[model samples]
Target chain A: MNRVCIVGVGSPSGDDQAGWLTVDALLDLGIRSGDGVVIEKLDRPGSALIPLLRSTAWLIVVDAMQGEGEAGQIQRFDETGWPHYGHGLSSHGLGVIDALMLAGELGSLPPRLDLYGIEIAGTTPGSSPGRAIRAAATRLAAMISDQLASGFSIPPGTQPGYG
Target chain B: MTESLRSVSIHVPVLARVEGEGALDLRIDNGEIAELRLRIFEPPRFFEKFLEGHLYSEIPDMVARICGICPVAYQATAAQALEKLFGVELDPWARDMRRVFYCGEWIQSHSLHIHLLAAPDFFGCSNAIELARIAPEEVRRGLRIQALGNELMDLFGARSVHPVGVRIGGFHAAPALSRIKEMRDKLRAALPEAEALVRWAARIPVPQDDQGFVSVAMRHPDGYAIEQGRIGVSDGARIEAEAFDDHFAEHHEPFSTALFCTYHKRPYLVGPLARLNLNHAQLPEAIKALLAETGLELPSRNLFHSLAARAVEILLALHEALRLLENYRPPDSPWVPVTPRAGVAIGCTEAPRGLLWHRYEMDDDGRVVSARIVPPTSQNQGRIEEDLRLSLLNFGLDQPDDALRLHCEKVIRNYDPCISCATHFLRMRVART
Candidate 1:
């Protein structure tokens, strides 16, 4: 039962890299690997997420979302609210939600999960995120840190540290 | 009553499930199909052109981007081609390791196609989600099997997607014996699921047709060919891999961006069906016995049975991979060092889809002078058209447009055609009058 933060990232440029940027921000805020928290950056995580979910109790996924929102808008969703986020949230081919659902079907879903989405202006091949999104990336990192420190208490499965 | 007739046109703006984007257009004139086109307008990635002037050593990883699903095929083919030009023999360990790595790919790609992509078509489900609702256990089983394939790739290549372990003369490094044993154990555990998949595929109601099309695949004396073989065609034409370009020609068509390939001025089939049909004799006795238990005869001509063929190959690959790993030992050195030489060489390997052919001409400096890559999908582009034309005739153009479209999609999918691979190398549009 590990608290795993799986960041879905893209090639180092553009809004798609928001996931990695958020991970960097979290690291800067002292969320080191050995601190009972593990972080990973993946490119099109897809079905590869299943094996990772096996040992995870709390899972946080940060990714860029495609939606009709101002650039850098932050959307926080728990397990129940995922479907309401619409299908276009993931910038990757299959997106994080699909992977989560597939994992659920395979009985590989972690008991607790959260998704942080940073809406972006665009994802042009070589372009980086807009300034607003960069600022939002920092904000989202703090929000995640706060949530993790609070013991991810917000949910359907909130049993404290059990082996 | 006065005689009257109306024209019909069916246009699918976006074809689903197959990798990448493409469309199908059908035109009907007075209940008769006047035209059918498979238009693949996905923009070309210009992989072959980009290979020019790159160091020979860099070609494997670069060409791998051609298709995520078959990156190992690209890497191995490129490595073999370059190694041939260098005139170096890979140590037996490297050769066997390459086969095992390739087996992982076949298992991964085939299982994905069978469970996630192709099987739903037979079940009349729109996608895996719906199929899951109908058969939850089956979908979960599929995921598990698919994961095993990825695990195998991870054990050898270090990571499946565009694995970096592949190098010019061999791998960048070899796996430990323990890892090999672990993978072997897992593969053995997955054997029943693989067998079940064959049985499941055997039951899928496929459209029956004796296509009588020319089937082509690689033939090796040792076993089912993956990396090495002579080109064997159903028409009894056997040619060396080096002579691939001599017998086949790629033709450009205005309607589609993918180049349609013709062997000796005729369309042919490849991929799982071709491999199984041609290499049935080469399969191990246990594998052949498993197929016999399915009660389906080998060398099937029904193109729809390609699904079954893919399932059979998955079983074969798992068995072969275990065998390759049985006596695994770390190589003295993972790769044979090579000095670049000036020459033209070719390598043809059976991708999960079909025969992937690569030819490279390099300067003495080891920089590529030119490169030509004929992916499996491009070679099947012509055969797909012929299948569509003939199958549509049997399907009857007078059927409702929706029925026609669904059947057409299934026909295209039966080949499990990778439109993305074709377009990067090379559309599809259908019109009728």
Candidate 2:
């Protein structure tokens, strides 16, 4: 019943910083940030995402992932349909899947959920993520901003404006 | 003894509900358990080996990666060791805030284990999903407490998982007073729920069996041990962290990927049960009174009481956090300057699981020359197997394989075994004829 939009950011350094970078881009675009929106930057949130997901009406998760697609590819995951593009479990104790599963089981998942994953080349401590991945993060942020500006619902089988 | 079944082998190729991966093998032949191995097969991440040549200031962050669940313990332990070597003293505010951060970990970790991992077995449920169908209210309460813990953690440490706030001498930065005040209010609001959780845990149908095992934990003169304390055992032995190496030794066993630790050549219990058993008298009066009011026995020998002990600790942590928050003051500087000195120093603190011991040898330029870390789960490995042997022997060996497996899982979960933390997911394979 709430009209809140939740954005979860990450704390990975190299390529995994895509999520954090996206949030930065969104802020730069001035996505209305009043009582209606809540943005959270987390360092390996793990299962802690449960409560946040439960309390909000709309959820958007930005994270760096590795999959079959070329690096810098952006994919969107819905509530019932999770992406299976080779993004395995998180290096943290519980990954995003663990949180989503727990939320579904507890009947606490928000009504509308959108997970934006940017395909990354590397996430090592010292290595830099590919330039394409950073561009994808900015593009992903614009897509989210446009969607939020309008009504934030996607028709069945239709893709968002941006990949 | 039932003569109908003379042999039993139980293999759970993969253990569910534990933090990491491992395996459990139980073999019973001729009415005797031939083998009971808590196999830890998770590949080591080689944290210690990689720590070499890293700047001394980076030790906290590097070691924090040891286990996501108990990162604070690793960070705090490493900081303490380096601080000792450099003769740096932390400001009082920073020291107390560390305890607050640790309390958050205890609350969240214990609540997660009790609700999501361990409790399902007590109700004949496979997981929290099934428990939700029956005990929805309890599950919700647990989630609320867990959320509060996360909130506290985020406020103080900047994030729940692998917090980066902690540094070598203290923290990277001190939080504003307003944030602390907000957290205090939330904690105070959740106080009743925490107490209710303790009461609820007290009522759980725990399997009964005495473990005549030695309990080891940290004891502090000021109050309940959280961040600072000396190691104390139930057998009246006390030692400082530096003396830990002299008394305790880790042995490599072919069966386990993790080393089995022993104190004075004997297995000892750590974690919540040990802390409660050894430091029952050290609890604040309010907590002690709450325990008396709840009517749970003190110094419990039954390993199953670990659940109740965890609940009590949660309540205590909430209370302690609130009290500490009442006197919130931001220090002029969060960290004290450290000058690199060449020395080997040891530090030990109680993780939510048990005692986390760290030793470090730093070079003159403040680079780590060598580092050794003994996490709580590794220390409890031998004791876990021993407890399993004794408990299984008493649970009546004639139970169905699944029943026995569940019982074994319960015993293992009682330790809240972070197989990942211990050098660990468990693939359980049991073979019986």
Best by DockQ: 1
Tens-digit per-residue lDDT, B3-90, candidate 1 = 1134777777655434666677777777566667788877777888899999988888898777777899999999988998899899
lDDT of 2 by residue, B369-423 (tens): 8888898888999999999999998897878777788788788878988773221
What is the per-residue lDDT of model 2 for residues A1-163, given as tens digits with 9 covering 90 to 100? 4555545455556788888778888888986567768876666665667777644777788877777798889989887678653223354445676566667766776667788788887777756656987799789989988888786543354321100
**What is the lDDT of every predicted structure here?**
0.79, 0.80
Model 1, C-alpha of A136: deviation from truth (Å) = 2.5
Off by over 4 Å in 1: A2-5, A32-36, A83-93, A153-163, B1-6, B420-433
lDDT of 2 at B248: 95
Best by lDDT: 2
Error of 1 at B407 (Å): 0.8
Q: What lDDT score is found at residue B304 in candidate 1?
A: 87
* Backbone clash pairs in model 1 (N, Cα, C under 3 Å; residues 3+ apart or in different chains), count: 19
lDDT of 2 at B307: 87
Candidate 1's docking class is acceptable
